[model samples]
Target: MQSSSELFPVALMSAELRGDLTEDVYRLKPANSPDPSVELVLTRLGRFGQEGGRGVPVILLHGSFSNRRFWYSPRGLGLAPYLARAGFDPWIAEMRGHGLSPRNQQYRRNRVADYARYDLPAIAAFVREQSGQVPHWIGHSLGGTTLAAALGGHYLGEEDVASAALFGSQVSRNYWPLKVPPVEWGGRMLLKRFEVLSGSWLKRGPEDEPIGLALESLRWHGLFGRFGDAERDWWAGLAEVRMPVMAVAAAGDLQDPAWACRKLLEQVPEEHRHFLLLAKDEGFSDDFGHIEMLVSKAAEREVWPLVAHWLEHQRLPLTTAALEAVAL
Candidate 1:
C-alpha cells in the first residue's frame, strides 16, 4: 500500500445509461489512512427521462457480502431505480473489494474501523463535492453499522450528512459463547488466518467479505468487549448525535431481532428519530426477514415508499420543538 501522502485523487471511472436511468460510477482513494491503496466506488443512478427534476442526493449502502446490486439488480430494477424515478439522485456505494471497487493492497487486513474512519469520509467528501450538498445516507446491515460508527466517532460529521436511515442494522445482538473470553479470542484467531470469506461458499450473499471484518466483530462481542474500537465507544457516542435518523427492523429477522434494532435506536438520545418494525403483528401482510425486509416484492410495494417519504420529509424545515419532542 502507498503512503497517505502518495494516494491518488478521486475520479470518474465510467458512465453509462441502463435503460432510461443514467449510471455514473466514481472511484475515491483515501487521503489519509494506513492503506492508501484502498479505493471505494460510488455508482450514481438518475432518471434520464426526467430532465429538470433532480431531487436531494441520497446514498444507499449495501451490507456485508454484497455490493451495489443490493440496491439495483443487473436487470436495471430495484430500489435505486425506484428512487431515481421518484426524483432523487441515488448513489450506490461499493465498499473496498465489493462490486466495482477493486481489492486494495491490504484487502485482507480491512476492518470496520478502517471503513468508518477512512472509506466513508472519502465517499461523503466526494459526494458533497460533486452534489454541493450533504447526502442523505441509507445503509443496511453492516453498512448501517458503519454509518453509525462514522456518526458516533465523528468520522462523518453533521456537515457531511443530511439525514440517515438504517435498515436491519444493529450491534447489540449477543452470540452466547462468543461473550466468553476464550471463545472470542479463539474465534478471532481462527478468522484471522483466512484472507476472505466467500459468500457463495457460505451461502450468505453475492460477494466475499475480508476476514478482518469477521475478526473485528468477534472482538466487539467478546468478553469485556463493547461496540467500539481502541479510540472510541460508538455505543455511547450515539447519544451525542442530533441529526434526523431512522432505524428499521424486521420481526422475523433472527439474524438481528427487532428488539436489538430498537435498542440501538434507543441509544440515540434525540427527538428526530423513528423506529419501524416490519412484522405481520404490526399490521403487515407477513413477518419480514433480514434480507426480505428490503429486497422483497413486498418491500417494493410497501416499504420503499415509506423510505421515499422519509427522505422527502427529511428535507422539510425543522418542526416545532414541541412536535419534534414526540418520537415517531
Candidate 2:
C-alpha cells in the first residue's frame, strides 16, 4: 500500500508541470447573434507514459462552485496522475463561475443550462481539436448532470462521447432537496428579483459568501433531496446514451444517498453499466461524506481503484460471459 506522503511527490511534480504548461485560454464567441462569450481554459498533463495510448482520452469535470484545481490537490484525491499511470491522458475542465472561468463580462447570470450549452461543448471541441480523440467524460455532481445533458442531445447535435462515468450524482426527487433556511429564502427571492431586473447580482467572494446560498439552490432545485422535473429530464437523457457508463456514490453521503445512486445505474441503457457504493467504514475514518469521495485521503485506496479497474476492464472490450465471471 502506498502512503499518502508517497502521493504528494507526484502531486508536486504535476503542479510543476502545470505551472510551466502553455495552453491557450480562449473566450468562445457564440455564432449567429453576438451573444456574450463563454470562457474556456485548457491545460495538458505533461509527458505521461500513455501519451500515445490507444484508449479514448479522459476528461474530468468538477461539481458546482468548484474549479479544475480541486483535482490537483497534493492529496491522493487527484486522479490525473493515477489515470496517467494507468495509460490514459487526463484533462480537467473548469466550468464558468468557478476558478479562472467566470460569467461573461456582458452577462453574469448563473444558469445551469449554460454549462451544458457552452462550457461542456467548448471543452469537448477543444479536446477533440487538441488530442484528435472523442474523449470519455467523468464528472461529479453538477458536472455529471451537465455531461448527461450534453450526451442526451439537449446541447450538442450528435454525441461525440464514447463513454462516461458519474460520481456522487443522481436524478431522483425523493432522495434529497435543497435545504435552504427560511430566513434566507426571502433574501434569495429578493436577489433573484434583482438579478432579473438589473441583469446581474453581486458576486460574493469565496470567503465572504455563506454556504447557505449554495445549499438553498440545491434544495430548491432538488439537487440534494427530492427529484424534480429538471432532474428527471436529466435522467431521461441518460437513457438516450448509447455508450457505457459507471455510476458511484458514498454510503454515508447525505447529499446523494447510496440507494439513489444505485437507482440511477438501474436506468442506464447500456448492459455494461456498473455501480459501486463505498461504505463509510471501508477505509475513511473522517466520516467521509459526499464530496470527499473524490477529494479525501481514502480516495486513492478506496474510490479510484474501482475506477482504475473499470477502465482497464473497459479497454479490453470484455464479453458478457467474461464480465459476469469478473463480477463473480
Candidate 3:
C-alpha cells in the first residue's frame, strides 16, 4: 500500500440520489493517520431539488457498530435526509471499518482515540474544502462520545465547527465492575482474545466493534483511570471547548442515563449549552430508549423538529428553570 502521504486527502468515489436528494460518497485518507489503509467514507447529501447549490453543512456521526444508515436510510427516511430537505447540507461519515468504509490493516487495533485525533479532523477538513464553510456536527451514542473526545481533546475547534449536538452520549456513567482492578484486568484479557465483538450475536446492532474499543473502555474505568489515553485528559480538555453545544439523553436509556448525560453537558461552560431529557415527565409522549430517542415515530413528531430548530438557531427552545420545575 502507498503511504497516505502519496494520496490526496479525499477522493469522490460515487454519486447518486435518493429521491430528490443527491448522495455523493467520498473516501477520506488522512495523511497524518498511522495507517494508509484506513479509508473513512463520507457521503454528502444535497437538498431536495437543488443539485447545483450547496447549503450550510451539518455532519452526522453514527454510534458504535453503526454507519451512515443510522442517520439516513436507503429509502431517504432519516435525520440526514430530513436535514437535507430542511435546506441543510448533511454529511454522513462512516468511521474506519464501518458501512461503506472497509476494514483497514489495523482494523482490530482501531480505537476512539484514533478517531478523535486523526479521522474526524480529516473528515472536517474535507467537508470544509468542499463546502467552503465551517460545518455543524451531530453525533449519536459512541459517535457522540467520539465527538466529545475530539472537542475535549482540542482536535476540533471553533474554526472547524459551527456548532455541535450529542445524542445519548456520556462518559460520566460508571461501570462499577470495571472499577475493580482484578475485574478490569480480567475483562481486558478476555476481550483481547477477539478481534471484534459480534453485534448480531450480542443483539446490540448490526456492525461488529473492534476489541480495542472494549479494552480502551476497561482501562478508562479501571482503578485510577480516566477518560483519556496516555497523551491528554479529554475530560479536563472539555473545559477548553467554547463552541455552542447541546446534549440529549433519554430517561429510559439505562445505557446512558439523563443525569450522566447532563453531567457531560455541564462540563462545558453554560453560556451556549443546552440539555434535553426524553421522558413523559418532561412532556414527551413516552420515555425513549437509547436508539428510540432518535429513530422512533414519536421522535419524528417531537424530537426531529427540535433538532432541526437547534441546527438552524444553534440552540433549543428551553424553558426557564422555574418553569421546568413547575412542569415537573
Q: For each candidate, what is the lDDT?
A: 0.84, 0.56, 0.86
Residues 23-63 of candidate 1: C-alpha lDDT, one tens digit per residue: 88777776578987887888988888664567788989899
Candidate 1, clashing residue pairs?
A: none
Give the per-residue lDDT digits (tens) of candidate 3, residues 9-68: 666787786778888888777757888788888888896568667778999999997888
Q: Pick the candidate with the highest lDDT.
A: 3
Error of 2 at 111 (Å): 1.7
Q: What lDDT would candidate 3 get against the real structure?
A: 0.86
For candidate 2, lDDT tens digit of each residue in 1-328? 2211211111111233333221223333332123455554444453433345434568888775566666655332377656655566667776654555545543435454555656677667656765677787888876776676666535543445756788887655352223444544554555554322211233311311123234334444542432223444554565666677777778778877878777776766757577756664433334456777877667765566556666655432134444334333
Per-residue error for 140 in candidate 1, Å, reads 0.5
TM-scores of the models, in the order given: 0.92, 0.69, 0.94
The segments of candidate 3 whose C-alpha lies over 4 angstroms from its true place after superposition are: 1-7, 320-328
Ranking by lDDT: 3, 1, 2
Q: Count the backbone clashes (under 3 Å) in each candidate.
A: 0, 13, 0
- The candidate with the higher TM-score, 1 or 2, is 1
State the displacement of the C-alpha of residue 124, model 3, in Å, after optimal TM-score superposition. 0.5
Whichever of 1 and 2 has more lDDT, that candidate is 1
